[model samples]
Target: MGVFIHWAGTAALLAQLAGAAVAWGADGGADGVVAVGVEEFLGSTGDSAEQLLRLDLDRSGTLRAREDGVGGGWRLRGSSSAGRIDGALLDAQGAMVFNNHYADADLRDNVHAFADDVVTAITQGRGLAASKLAFVGSREGRRQIYVADSDGERIQQVTSDAALKGSPSLGPGGVLMAYTSWQSGFGDVVLKDLRDGRERTILSAPGTNSGAAFSLDGTRLALTMSYQGNAEIYMASVSGSRVRRLTHARSVEFSPAWGPEGNRVVFCSDAGGGPQLYVVGRQGGAAERVETGYRHNTSPEWSADGVHLAFTGRQGGGPAVVVHDLASGQNRVLLARGEEPTWAPDGRHVAAVLDGALVVVDSVTGRRRTIVRGFSEIREPSWSR
Candidate 1:
């Protein structure tokens, strides 16, 4: 038997977690202190579920758990019975705000779903607690693809190629994954069905094939293929049966990422004498430069909302994660030192590699928390929708 959870709430918590002083409400008031009660469980499930829920809320950047003595705001309380956990959200006056239930054979999955629901009810925004991440990690001196929950738990290796692999991209809902592998002595794009553990070489063209990205619809892929003599951005069917070249630049073009609408692709190129960002249509056309005011920019990932673009930019002679507003043309550095950033489903946070560990950063508040570590080297984290 696994764990189950139920919760509900009416009022929302609009607070920002910053420094030691916690502020709640729209005006950053000291009132309305939010807290998560320790969950009571039967058997030996322990308090892991409660701890996970608390961590999820804290990482949201919109909520924090106040101490026991703190008063006001809403409180989350729950208990378990026969592997079933029932919970509710109560107002400061001890009145019920909301109630709901969740059941899954996997305890972690149940907790993640519950956390996501709580975040949505309070913040009116999507929660990444249940999202999935795919990245490249080294094992036995060989790099392979790995997957883990958004909280960096339940880590699973997806590939055992025993060869170098990189550029991992997860499809919509995380049912499919695409990555570049060197098992054939050439960079080839391999697609894997995460559920059934089945994989196939999707793009095995001569020269090198890499930088594969799934479209918003997951029906097509945009990648950089050099089989045409020079590396250029190309679009191919998910089965790799039909290929359409999208870029013909003399300078090498790679790291293609799909726009939110699936009609445009943003990629990195050295055509401007230095690595920079460019956008091209899905049907193939002249690329236009995306001025980031930086000498070097790469790994452009569009936010789910289609309003912002996250990429790696050179700052202070080191790599930094930068977010560029497509509408206002304003660029802000999210991380002082990080690279290969991928946006969370909510578009409010980003995951990147920092000092050989995976760190999630709140793009709005610039708050960072390390989620996954102890890997030899992690690179190119791709978050599922």
Candidate 2:
């Protein structure tokens, strides 16, 4: 059997046989490698739940699931009964770390909760299992807004506008969604409440209004509008009132994304003769170029920790997903053939469109898997925090 070793901090963890082990923090200052073992669950939905939890844990990249015969550092056992799932996490010495009963209405919901709980207990970091994604999907030659779980399950169409829709952005907690719709013969920003199914035109400017993004706090939005004759970034309240202009570049500015602190916004501009990334204050000021070393970049999405900025950059005559470090002032390509990158809640993974399919990519290891596909076309994905 081959052995794999991974180094973290000052220690190296070994993965034995065919199973991989990852190092994570434990309670009481104990830090070591962890390999989780799963036992077959019993009940009506037990089999499906077990499979899903294992898949999610592996996809997290923070831990691994042990094979049937391989020994593990922790054991996960669960059961489903009467529309509820009971799950428990135990250490090697049989110490209980987590034991909870999830009463979600759907099996996928319960599985997501259990998987997120295990990841949090082991790594002390946020989990992406429960996150949702909003993107533009085409059906019957018409584009519409659609929402689905991070795992590409429970997909539901959010809009029925048969005209054209794009640039779907999900607000905090996935409660509200904003997108650009061409149903009225002009590109306008439409805000929809996912709970009550209420739709309202948030920005119906004369020329065009598109690329709407919600603030980190979900109270404000940053978008592009041409009502004033030239495309410029603008800020507005969530209710589409109190509108304020953020950028006044004569060369055109669009695709505005808010920083995690909400004090600054990054967007794409052609002021320098090519589409480049720039940062401007929320209150409007002189914009500073981000210096990505790329002649063209667009669709900027800030990480949850506010440390990295992911966007689409031109590479090899095609669109590539690139991440720029804010502090180190460095840029690295995450995907060679993807665009319109969005960050997962964990900030370590990104979702982008590759070959007309939505895929989730691990920024560190460069591993990726298709999460949403089979549509006529998919683009502009937005992940919930």
Best by TM-score: 2
Candidate 2: global Cα-lDDT?
Answer: 0.85
Q: Model 2, residue 222: what's the lDDT?
A: 96
After superposition, the stretches of candidate 2 with alpha carbons farther than 4 Å from their true spots are 1-33, 69-72, 91-93
True-vs-predicted CA distance for residue 208, candidate 2, Å: 1.4
lDDT for model 1, on a 0 to 1 scale?
0.81
Q: Could you tell me how far off, in angstroms, the CA of residue 35 lies in candidate 2 after the best superposition?
A: 1.9
| Stretches of model 1 off by over 4 angstroms after superposition | 1-46, 66-77, 81-100
Residues 158-220, candidate 2: write the lDDT tens digits. 888577778888888788999888989999888899989998998898898999899989999
The number of clashing residue pairs in each candidate reads 7, 0
